[model samples]
Target: MKKANTHLVLNCIIAEESITIEDVVKKTKLSRPTVVNIIKELTEKNIVFKSGFAEYTGGRLPTLLSLNANSYFAIGIDFEYPPIRMAISNLKGEVVLSQGITVDRSFSRNRIIEEMFEALERMIGESGIPMEQFIGIGIGLLGYLKANQGISLEILRIPEWKDVDFKKLVKERFGLPVYMQNDIHMMALAEKRLFLTDRADDFAYVGIRPGIRAGIGLAMHINGSFYGGVHGNAHLLGHMTIDINGEPCPCGSKGCLELMAGEPHVVARYKALLGDDPDAESIRGIRDIHARSLGGEAAASRILDEVGSYLGIGIANVVKLFGLTTVVIGGPDGELYYGLLRDHLKKNIFKNMSGELDIIVGRLEEEMYPLGSCFLVIDQYFKEPTLDL
Candidate 1:
């Protein structure tokens, strides 16, 4: 009961930003005495502290309680991209320091782990923070995961990653608790907390990566919590069938959304239309295609329009199913052509449906991916301790 009460009081304080004991009681529905005792205990533990008196209008100025913000720290590592990104974050979820190490699929699994360890050691030494101050480490990787067990069910394109128990490995190495999650899901958590914490509680983040290794992912924040769906495979928006008769996907589906609307397809469609043009040979990636679209290349513009329309169709289906009003398009490829994509996306979304929906480009930097992983640890640190019944 005490543990649950503490959790409630702490969450109330966090939600209100800063609050007096009276407000905590009111918000948490706990008795004033219980609230006071919890606050006292929390302050002594440095989990929270007295900020300042509330106001002069009151006879006895109530002391405002706020999270200490540095009582503990967490480490976040992201392996979704080529570079293994790592960061240290305080209790308030602010990144204290961060670094990235290059480790692609070409490296052996052992080599990747060694590189990560070295980077982590260097970061810890530079931060001057004691190991005792850390709550745990969080890892974000691509593909599905047994998130509760911190096991990698499978990482697409990485042949040896099946059923890897990342949580157990990290815990044994560092003697700290560990959490694992899909990288895109972690990014969605960061998106909600960093950008939309105040404005919206429920929204969706759409991340698109285009290449020989093309993909699209979806992460939804439902009622202020990350929704990973059953089996954590809900993020496989790339495989969402858009056409039953279109080209077959590697996932054994035809007309999958990623095959039709992913940026690599945009570039391919542009080249197919520009047949035998020697200039087409110089067009290497999405960025080159985007430049052409900007320079009024009709072929490039048309391809982008087609891709954008396809993306809108997919996004609209998601919004309608989930009843979400806001959607954020993120990832490197999503951001690069967002300007051109947004117009076509909005048009198609409206064409298919008749409700208001806000589609915005993500404003966070690449580091948000790692920071989002850190949040997994930070969030767990504040939750009520539980026991098996």
Candidate 2:
């Protein structure tokens, strides 16, 4: 536990900037002598290196230390969708190397896994670094996670994904500790860390893409403690009713928010606008609209406006429920919707509400989903109860 604590302190230093033994003592609440002893061990290991002395104040200056960025690397990956992305990020979250592949969704499970692992091995080998330098893998995926079994219950409308034990299988094959979480949850964490105040604990994150999901939160200090409700499905945006008689959803809910605002709806709407076209042409159109949206096209702008409204309505309902101040939107369509999602949401929700709510775009994009998964692995390994670092 002491060694683990030492590793944790060094990691914290790396994530933040430089820190002194006093800061470690304060943050970790370890005695100064204990902190000194651990720092000495880390220094001998070459994981934590002395940078310089703190600026002189009144008394003797203290030495500052930080983890060598290249001393350790965390692999972040999101295996939720196609184009599997992997990022080799430093202890400070600076990505050093990244690689992605276009996935053939129809490929056999093992085959796809084999290809992804092969790609990972090649990238790691090309980095010319020892595997010892890696902190293991973190994965974020979009699925209903049965945490006890390490099984990801994912339903992406794609066949051949029934009862899959993703974590156990990946751990067995890769010989690494694996940690997985809901893709949107990880993205929400990254979003909070980047754009929102770190002190702000809870906010709902709604995703609209290959699937629709929500991670609603109420992590306010005044509320006494962060609340996620009993079921952790307080913000079931996909199940929220949008149109009473519009469409049927898989979750036995009719006209859910997701069915209305999600990618399927957008695809349906886009197809309606495009009339009849070849299959290839339709695919191109979807990709093209996203491309043009990225490039700031007026047509794309209008479409996002419509889609953003649906997003706003769903988020507005969340705000009305939890009253949390922030709502983050992410998915494949993140780039297109971020620009005006908040404005539209506020415009509609505030009309009936007394409290002020903030809507923000997700800093973690589609790529971050996999990256979050990788982060999960790295984090749990660091915090593993039995590990001694």
Candidate 3:
């Protein structure tokens, strides 16, 4: 309980750049002596520093405290898909150094882990940050994960990753605590901390990764907590059947949204529409489609409209089910297609729903995954002690 109080007090101070003991006591509802003692301990550890004196009321001025942002560090990695990304972050959630390595199916699971370890080691060595400052490692991946047990039950795209004890492996190899979560869930966590801290707590994050084989993935924030249902696969919204008899998905479902609006499918639809055009051969991916749409190509625009309509249907179902007022679209493909899809998505959602909804396209860009993974570690500092990492 004392440790928990200390954490809470530290979080209060961190949240407010410069705060007094009275402020922390008020925010945490802890007794004044407890807040003072915790602040003293933190100051002794150099984790919290005396910034300056607060305003002088009638009596003496109280000392203001602030977090020492560089006192600790964490490492985060996103290994779900190609171009594995990793970063080292400070206590303030600022990325000090980040790097990426591309991989293909040819790289076995063991090989991927080995390469990841090497890259992380090289990064730490180059950054000149002391290893002792790092609290733990956080990893975000694509799959059904038993995050509490640090085991990945199944990864849709990587068949070889079945039943792997990722938490134990990482912890044993690095001699540090490890936290694991689904990629989309991690992104939602990041969104909560970085972008939506002042917004609604009940929102949904929908991500579309093009090459992962798995369709769209979703993570929900309910009542200020990330709700991963039993089996850690709740809200597989991508697999939702938008078309009853449209196309077969690997999940054995017909007319799933992933197959209908995912990047690869959208690209294929564009190519098919081009049908024997000499320029059709140049259309390789969604980016090309986006470019053509920007160039006012009628076929490309029509294909994007269709994709957006399908995505809107999926998002509408999510909004109706969760009664969510905000839906944030993210992921590599999502970033590229968001602008093209926003209006159609909004129109379909408004047509289906009764109230106003805030549809936001994520702006985290390339830092989305790694930074989210980093928060997987940073979040430990703010959660209640009884909560599992």
Candidate 4:
């Protein structure tokens, strides 16, 4: 009962940013004495502190209490595919440390895991915060995850990661409670909590990554809550069929949107447009292709134009299916190519249906994935437990 009251008071303070005991009492419906006791306890622990005095009235002013953002911390790791990233965040959702490691295909999964551990050690050591200060670790990974069982069910070409128990592995190494979720879900959660603060806004977020194998995902925030499907794998928009006789996908579908707009396809298209075997290093990834497009390379621009059209078709389908007016494009590729892709994507969407759709790039970009991962832990730490008789 005491812990619940403290959490309730703290949540009230966190929501208002700064409030007096009278305000907290009214908001939480707790008695004056109960609110005072919880505030005293929280203040002594340095979790809540007096920010300043409230507005001056005719008499004495009330003290304003605010949550100390640095009281506790969480470690978030983005383990989606390669270039695994991590971030340490405070209760305020601010990143204190961030780092990543890109693994070569030649490197075994064991090697990659070792790199992750080493990175964690270095990050913790560098943060100058005590190990006990960290609440837990949050991890976001690609494909479907059995969140309750702490297992990943994604069928991967990487044999070592097939159905791996990542939660157990991380907990064993760090001895901290671990939380896992689909990467796109994490991103959507973070987007809602950190950036999209408006409770009435319903939107769909699309993350696009261009690499050896491209990744595309969708996360929806409807009615102010994440809409994870019954199995938590609802929006696999990349696998949506765009062509009837296009290239086959590993997901056992041909003419998939990913095949037409993914990095491999983009590179293939660019090379074909060049009409010659270009140096392999000249166009390493979508980043490189974006650079070429910026450098006035007609082939790269043409490829982006086509890719945008295909992506627009896919996004249009999502908008119509969900009846969403706002769509956010995110991920590294989205950040780099949004300007180029926006008009094309908009035009294609208008072609499918006439409506005013707000298409924009995600504000968090590359940082959202890791930060969102951290939020998995942060949200749980402050979560108000359910009351059951």
Candidate 2 lDDT over 270-331, as tens digits, reads 66665665642443333455765678766655666776777677676677666667666666
The RMSD of every model to the true structure, in order and in angstroms, is 2.6, 5.1, 2.7, 2.7
TM-score of each: 0.90, 0.78, 0.91, 0.89
Q: Evaluated with TM-score, which candidate comes out highest?
A: 3
Please give the TM-score that candidate 4 achieves against the real structure. 0.89
- TM-score of model 3 relative to the true fold? 0.91
**Which ranges in model 3 have alpha carbons more than 4 Å from their true place?**
211-215, 294-296, 333-336, 347-355, 387-389
lDDT of 3: 0.81
lDDT (Cα atoms) of all candidates against the true structure: 0.80, 0.63, 0.81, 0.81
Q: Is candidate 3 or candidate 4 better by TM-score?
A: 3
Q: Residue by residue across 1-389, what tens digits does model 3's lDDT show? A: 88788878988888899998888888999999888888888888889999999998968788899999888888988876666888998888888999888776787888877888888889889989887888899988777778788898876677687899988988888898898888878777777777887988898898777663645889999998888886567788888999998888877889998888877777777888888889887777777887888999999888888887888778877887778888888876666667766676667655655457877776556665788888889887556687443
List clashing residue pairs in candidate 1: none
lDDT of 4 at 127: 94
Ranking by TM-score: 3, 1, 4, 2
TM-score pick, better of 2 and 3: 3
Worst window of 10 by summed lDDT in candidate 2: 212-221
Report how far residue 20 has shifted in candidate 3, in Å: 1.8
RMSD of 4: 2.7
lDDT winner between 1 and 2, please give it. Answer: 1
Between candidates 1 and 2, which one is better according to TM-score? Answer: 1
